[model samples]
Target: MTNEKVDVVIVGAGASGSVYASVLAKAGKKVVLLESGPDWQLTDLISSEIWGRRVKPAGAPILLEGKNPMAYAAQGGWGVGGAALHYYANFPRLLPTDFRMKSEHGRGHDWPIAYEDVAPFYDKVAREIGVSGDARAEEKWRPAGEAYPMPPMKTFRNGNIWLKAFEASGIPMVPAPVGMNSVEFKGRPACLYDGWCHVGCPIGALANPQVTYLGEARKAGAEVRAWSTVTRVLTNPAGTRVTGVEYYDDKHQKQTQEASVVLLAAWSAQNPRLLLNSATDKHPKGLGNASGLVGHFMMSHHVASTWAMFDEDVQNHMGTIAVQYMSYERYPKKSHDGAFGSSFVTAGFAVKTTDLANSRADLYGPELADYMKRAARNLAGIKTFGEEQPNVENRVELASEKDEFGMPLGRLIHSFDSDAVALWNANFEEGLNVARASGAKEAWSARGTMPTSHLLGGTIMGTSAANSVVNSYGQSHELPNLWVAGPGIFPTEGASNPTFTIFALSQRGAERMASQWGTLTN
Candidate 1:
């Protein structure tokens, strides 16, 4: 085995890891970012949907199928850019009430930090990442912050239809702020409105990691090693601090890297998995499981959606990946039932030819061609993505089976709570009503098994070590030098895409780590 040393070691070069690396490197820290996936760039993203399916990690086969069925339908980008490469650039902030869930509605745990505490960080992140929207329109519930960097993307025909329905229903339909560029900013070109963002943005108009933080971090002298699968965090005989990580390189050879501090920035599932796998005589349950809560409190956004076929050509397919909509009215506090409110967006962009085929197949294949022919005439679909209360039962644990690498794989155990189900039902009924109001021949509600891109809550944070795995600053209570930077540190899953919050927390953690680097020792 080969060994090397660095000031800081970060695992997983996804959204949070990339941001952490950028901030630390800019602060003049020597950093090494290890990614299990290969390094990929915008130029590597092919424009075709078929090519997109072939874009999984070089050697990590899709682990969601067969005997080791995934606990949830998890989908994320694999590579140095991580899942941000395939993320739809919806950059909405969690409402103020989302922070104090337990105090406000008597549900789930509250965040250790409030909206006010994180608001400045949010504003800074938004400006740095270049969000585009009218902040004034979202002022009702969105936490106070600086205005968006650019004007909202132009409303397409389908967006206009949703706006009309929203107005008629007394539900606000303000522009949804997005990460897609509306105008040239920070040297990146404006969005082409091509509707292929879910696959990946090849033109750098969207703020994926490759086009934003990772690209900047590389230029700032951070070293990113892809295809480096970390197996365990090595520590001194005392087990009081992390010394380095033992990993399997691309060639399946073992190696170790020494570091003064270690940051676990992997996604929700993998973050807890790694911690659980790092057990020793001192931490038999897990590295930081003194409270026995390393992989508990798993949460995912509850999703509900409805599609309508309209007589008018609503341009069913065209425009940016995300088109338009509103979410302020759905703030959790407004419902008064202690249930989280629902957020809706109009999927007005053109459905790719492949999506059209798949949607037809999903509805039954006999009328497939006819459905495609009438797709343009139908125009719009409303999708509601909401927050779920954190339930300890819904968790990530290790199964008896092992992965191809002979390491125990993650077993996800999750289910929606009564509150989540109530919100989902209400949103579904509301969406159907809106579709009917929009002059639809038929309105169909879809509630497929709730899968989400916004993964949150596992190695949660709290004011005290007894209540959470990590402290407010993301430093583990049991292991001082081992920190976490990702959505996995969230105590609550607010109804917003997690990228912005992830960036903010990572910046905060990196700042804290950089200032206290001298105190942390291997």
Candidate 2:
């Protein structure tokens, strides 16, 4: 056991974990962030898509057994910067109505707080991270928040091709908000516009955790130890507070780190898995499983691409691959009765052979050769992001199998409900219509719906302790000193990339924890 104690110990040096470390450490707390992957840094981020796969998490494999199994290996982060190291940095905020779904639509669970409550944090993170976009262009669907810090990213010829389709179809399109810099800000360089971002950005232009909070945390004197896998959350005899955690160091030796406060930001699935695996005599279900909802409500969005083949070269390989144009203004809520979620349409995607969305892995021989030849210079792509409703049946449980550390493996089970399928169908049709209207010589979509890496729910936050593991601030209802950070606390995730929201919530929770340290620790 390590006798030295700290004020805060955070598990997972990923996006939200690094945010808390940065904020609380800056506020003078003794903080330590434990990461289970390699000690990666900015220089380690190579420009090759194959090399970028190094950043994806690979500590322990969870037994995925769902009709819609999430692609965790591709979406999760393994090292210092975490998943942000290779992300496109699509930084759109959640819609306002997303917070009050049950109240307005009588579908999905309502968030404990509203969009207004998180708006300030959104602005704070945006300014700090230097987001780029035109707020007025997104005014129709954008929630109330301060304007982006930088000008929108440069649009390409592919955007022009998609813009006509949106216009002709009477759908609205706006410049997509992105975390990559449009201009030099806060000492970071500007983007190179090489469209090679699918792998990772070696330059500091993209606001990955290495260039953002994780960097700030290092400057603020927060200690981060890589290959430190936390296995259990140690608690007091009364099970009312957490003392710290037990983890395996790089040597695979069991060690203990003592702290007054412990926070778990180890992704959506692992957060609940850690809680459940920590089951003890005092709490057999788990540290935060008294409510029996810690592992329930696991959800992931369905992302489908609609690619168009143009007669003339649209320069699809030109600019940012995340998306050049965005559309959300044409979503008809009344038209789709069974579908009950937001639809986020993004245009301008470059074909990356590593990505399943672009590669037809099932095709071979002449068909494969022909498809590759046509896709080389003629393909322009758009994607439809449909939010999945929270279902209790989709959950994470402790599998009978154990890892090298003797800890039970996490069993992830998820399936698309009727409503989710409806939402996907509706969103897919909407995307196909826009593509056909664009005067493309050919238009086609991915063979089937693809599960997004954007995982949510599982150990959700709510007003009551009976149904939720944490509160709006990510404070545990069962153990005050043990909180679950990250997207796992989300009651409902809107059809938007969650990295920005993760940063905002981490900022909010960390700021509050710093301000109310005396009360929180007591």
Candidate 1 positional error at 284, Å: 0.6
The candidate 2 region of ten consecutive residues with least summed lDDT is 350-359
Error of 2 at 469 (Å): 0.8
Model 2 RMSD, rounded to 1 decimal:
1.6
lDDT by residue for model 1 over 1-522, one digit each (tens)?
856688889999988898888888888888899988778867778877778764444443323422213333224667777777877777777767777878887777788888887778778877887888889888876656789889998777767777767778777777888888989889999988778787788888888888788887888889998889987888778888888888888887888988888899878878888899999998899888898888888777766667777778777566766656656566554552545544544445556776565443466565776777887556467777776777787777777677657678777766776777777777788788888887778777775655454668889998777889998778998888999978889988777777778888887777788788777762
Residue pairs with backbone atoms closer than 3 Å in model 1 (clashes) = 77-83, 193-319, 310-378, 317-350, 318-350
Q: What is the C-alpha lDDT profile of model 2 across 1-522, one tens digit per residue?
A: 584899999998888998999999899999999888888866776777777777777878989887888878877778777777778789888877888878987877889998988889989998998999988788777565578999998887777788877887777788899988999989998887887776677788888888889889989999998999999999888877889999999999999999999999988999888999888889999988889998999888887677788888777667876787887763434445667677787887555555423446567788877877776777787887878888999999999999999999999998988777788787778778888998888877675545665889998999988878899999998788887888898998878888889899999999988888997688
Error of 1 at 244 (Å): 1.0
**Per-model lDDT:** 0.76, 0.83
Off by over 4 Å in 2: 330-338, 355-362
